[model samples]
Target: EAMLLSLYDHACFVLGHLEWSEGMRGNHYLACIAGLSVAAAYFPACRWTAQLRRWCAEQLRIEARYQFLPDGGNFEASIAYHRFSAEMLGWATWFLNRTPEGHNILGRDREFWLLLERITTFTEQTTYRSGVAPQIGDNDSGRFVSFLPLADDAESYGTWHADPHPYLSQRNHRETCALLRAVCRNEEHILDALFDDQTQHRQACFYAHTFGVAVLRNAEAEVFLRAGSIGQRGKGGHAHNDQLSITLALDGQEVIADPGTGIYLAQPAMRNRFRSTRMHSTLALDSVEQETWCEGGGEALFWLTSDRAHARIVAATERLIIAEHTAWHLPHRRVVRLEDGTLVIEDFFAAPSEATIWFHLHPHVRADRTGEGVRLEMPQAHAILTASGGATIMLEESLYSHSYGVWTPTRAIAIQPSGTRTQVTIRWQLRS
Candidate 1:
């Protein structure tokens, strides 16, 4: 029983040391509260157990109500952190339901289940047919627990090894859906509909207005677009300046891809580079970033603030999605449409502006510039990008990181319009 007592002591120590102030709010705070609940329930006889339980219960309620939106999207704006928060709350609620004192904490509450349901819905909508979540924002691949065996190297604790695609393919949507099914018991039908491939294919568009994200999917292709706030109120923490960016997949293979986040903290230059506008698949004006990163000491390090850039979905339908974002007092709009087997993107600028629209290709995809436009060749898929309005098309060297600390050389198509306003179209034709 000495081991059990030691574990209890450690739990108490963790609970005692958690900073309960406003500054300590976030995933860290929620994790500590969850640990405290587990500890209190385990050692109910402890003198501080009652008080700790009350504090944790109240904090859980408050966080559930405030940290997440009405549609269940985490206000933090990081999809990785969204999953992290959901797992924390899921564990806490699951553990609490087993204890007599905590049985009613999340009991039969419509609002509570609705929150979880919406979050799960968002995740389902964003997940690709290959079971990978689009690397929309910062993705450190953080997890609360490591159920899988780890590599022997200590430094490899946080860094993703090789390509994260295989790892993501193994656990991304399946686990999240399973957790949602377990926690929100009343929402089984919703989960079933989301997980069912037949049902998902019939649905053309999945738009989360609350998060400003839209996913267009069909039997043969999937497109993910981002036109949302720059990472929670433009603070830009864990957010890339990729407003109006798009990621494309065809025949269950990624073609145009988001350069997944590279190393963090260890290499600030690389961090800034990976999060820069040049690395993303979007338009960059005068090569200026939409948000500026501040290099400060300690926790404020790498904090970013936008230059008054904002994004909104102006129009959305099963076949088309139009989104607009304003940066530096100039509005840039992107219109994406899926017609037959062709995927078309039309970019519009309010004024004559020197801008470059980028389309970053997956490392495996081959590209050749044709007279009409560019020919993209991927496994089981092919596409041709045709630009109008006198746009100059060129290829540039780029980088793609499937995992942290590992970067691969890639290429991106840069479309520079000669006039103030121009339209470029990418016609993707899948080969059977």
Candidate 2:
């Protein structure tokens, strides 16, 4: 009772003088609202507690409508961060359901419940069969809470304690799933499938137009395309210069990988390179970034400003998806199609421009150069890449980070068309 009273007192103080960031409506502020509401629910009968819970319920409803898009993607545009914010929302839902007063806030909140279900579905969709979430945008391994016994987050400027294993990685995605399965009315079996690393999925392509991501899956492989906006309403704090980038998963392994965020702030140079357009599996004109990177400090530490790309999907279907973005002062269009178990990617532009295309191999994959392209040997499959344009393929050293503050040396296939190009069609054939 005393703990409850103390929390109630603290909630009142916080409500009286709230400090919201002027920059963005991010999870940092929403988390505080969720925490204060949870505390108020513990003493629902107290007058201040009652008032605080009402305010939190209203604010959550308002922010969640904007923070999570119609398809349930967190507007930060980072998949790892979705897990963090979803956990906070799920936690608040669990406790709020327990109290009669809190019930008024949630029981009839149909829109909120639908958002939770959508968020849950998104988590299940984006995670790979390897049990890792895509390092799509910025993956700093943020977590709302760690229930594990030995989990400790590595600081941006400190020695890595996330050793021997990625305990600090929130990409496992099960924690958020577990909470939603219990409280969000999503089917338990769906969440159950994610926990076991089910290697296969239902037969159909999936696309979230609201999030601007497209997925193509077969019995043994999955293809993901990041063709979306510079999220955070163009602030780009957590977004990357990864427009038209793609990743491939085969037999539960990430064969074609996106270099996850290297340590931020501490190693600013590495951070800049990792988030650069060149580090992604996409085309960059004259080796320029898709979006100009924010360098140095403060907002530059996270923001990817000058977001004029306006990347988006032009057309999509069960078997084909096409997207384009105008960055580097040119329009680059990518067409993704799967035929006869081979993934075909075609890039098109109107005028000739010096262009470089990158396909980053997972650290575990073995890469060898061939006259036509490069051959990739992954644990689950072997694949070969070829291009229609004249290619000068070079094996370049790259880095891959699965969790915060940790990275391993990898190799990338950097393809520079023999000359400035107007069209480049790259295709990959995978063999089991």
Candidate 3:
């Protein structure tokens, strides 16, 4: 207990200096440092040992390096951080008996409490209704949990952590907030609904680049596509050179995906190399990606119409979409329609430009080149996809490996968009 108090003391001292850089700041780290400092003193324990003192002090120092943003957003770009901060602050407030002066060793716990709440509020505003957080940073589907709401000062601090944090131990930012609200209201039904074990929820998911395009979908096959840019403002880390990209779901599973941001410093070499456009399902003209490691440029744009000739749910019963975007730069207007129970992507682009288009699937999904265009085989689902027609598609072996898990390609196919204002199309179908 003494050691934890000392760590908190050290954190307060370091943060008093205010020297955190943009690359190293985040909300969760701040909350953890604050929470740990307060937790150490609030909870009873045996006499503090010298080793514990040293560890706590070191943690305080390390955490101080992470400063909070003006909007109370974390610099790391992950919504999970925001949720974690909120819970930490709530715990800190409850532990100190809601009095800042009570934890004398930690000094001002109130600042941490307020900051965590503010950050969480920002996250709540950004979260989509489907529960999937924006792919702002290093995110995978694995981070999901549901927490129930509880009333403020209605429960003991220790009991709150013991009860809620465990079940939501691995939940994402949105789940944590929902859980908090449920607990606050004392709504048993909401708590039970969120706590139901062993079920998967994937709805209103989106992956987007700044000034590029944002893609989302509900349970139905209809895709919601929004546009953004290449993150010219450097708003977040792991920004991609994919000036214009697409995000969608196929057969109720994630298919085309952003090769996510990998860890930094912990594995410095892996950063920025693999998370570029060569990994997504978007097409690149002339084998060119927007830019590499801050060396290229292009704007990601979008146009939406809730009128006729816009987002028609054709093949609705068959589970497909035919989307048409008004004319933009380049030479041709493009209409993307998925049919034949396979992802058949057709493109009509501007004047004759030598552009090489590639179809990239998630690394976990297998890919191989059959005499057909290119086929993706999912082992878990036991399905195969073949691509053919004017498109020269074939699955190629990949040189990069994923750290989260081991996966190999079944195939990849590249197509050359031909003709001036040419209308080119490729078809995909599933095989038994």
Candidate 4:
């Protein structure tokens, strides 16, 4: 009890400092209040504990309402980070519900309870049946628990002995899902309503509109599309220039994949490369980034000029997702349709301009340039890609990071318009 009280005091001292910036408010704020709340509950009788509990109650309410959209998607926009923040909130939820004395009115906080249920749903929907998560934005591989402790004082506050994979791995994600399932209960069931891989709460399609992400899954494949605001109310600290990007997995193997975050501010050049527009599977204005301000620099490694992408999904359904963005002031639209192992992507530009479309593949997936676009092959699957609209196709060497600090060589397919065009269409047909 004494140790907990001492920890609470230190937590308060740190959290009491001048409010965090807008970008930090998303995950960092919720985590702070959650820690303080948990520590305060250890000895609820003390006057100091009472004060901490009240402060945490009010602060938690604000954090939940602001950081998580009604659709349960996190505004920070990184699935890995969402799991990190959810850990803090989930424990808070369970504690408040079970510990009657320390919750400080949170037991009856209807909004708090509702948000947890929603967050849980969104997290599950975004997670693949393989238990891997999409690297939509910056993924520093943050998580709630670790068995491996930081081994060296000079390792810069990281578990040097930790496994290469963080929240991005199947094992890590499953642990998180199990934790979430324990606290999130629903009084409903429809057989096969969710992913066939699970008995309950498995959804074939999930639209987190407020967060600009739409997911579609069938027996053979899962398609995830990004079309939404850069998170943190456009401050975009963890945001990526992935507006209109696509991540597709066929039969549990990634073909067109997002380059998972490799490292953070430590490697400024690598950091910028991983988040740059070219790194995503999307069209860019001849190499120009969706967020122009993020170009050509290493400083402010955590900052981005908000709203530059101005991307959003115009329409979405289980089979189709259509979204548009104005990167470099050129209006562009991408329409993606997926069904029965076949997919079509249509890129339309309002006016002609030099541009390129890149599709990064998983390291395990071999590829070769075809007369049209490229051919993609994984363990038990093969795909043929063909492009129209007068673009030369090229297969290039690239890098893919399954988790933080580990990278593997991969192949990337690029579609470069010979000159300029108003429209381009690429089709991927998958076969066993």
Work out the TM-score per prediction: 0.86, 0.86, 0.53, 0.84
lDDT of 4 by residue, 1-432 (tens): 778658866776867763557545777667677766676666546666666667777777778788888888788877777888877776665554444443547666777778878888888887777666788887777775533222235332122112333232422455555555665552123112222223235577778878888888877888899988787776777888899999988765667889887787567788888888889998876656688455454657767765766788888888888888886677778888876757888787654446778888877777876665577766657778777656677888888877777777788888775543323333445453
Show pairs that collide, candidate 2. Answer: none
- What is the C-alpha local distance difference test score of each model? 0.71, 0.73, 0.40, 0.71
lDDT of 3 by residue, 281-394 (tens): 445555443443432222111111111111111222232333332222343233344444433444555533556555545545655555643445542233344433454444
lDDT of 2: 0.73
TM-score of 2: 0.86
Model 1, span 238-315: residue lDDT tens: 678788889988876678888878878777778888888777777887757877777644444346765466788888
Better of 2 and 3 by lDDT: 2
Ranked candidates, highest TM-score first: 1, 2, 4, 3
Regions more than 4 Å wrong, model 4: 1-24, 102-104, 146-172, 186-200, 294-299, 350-353, 371-373, 418-432
Q: Candidate 3 or 4, higher TM-score? A: 4
Against the true structure, what is every candidate's RMSD? 4.8, 4.8, 12.0, 6.1
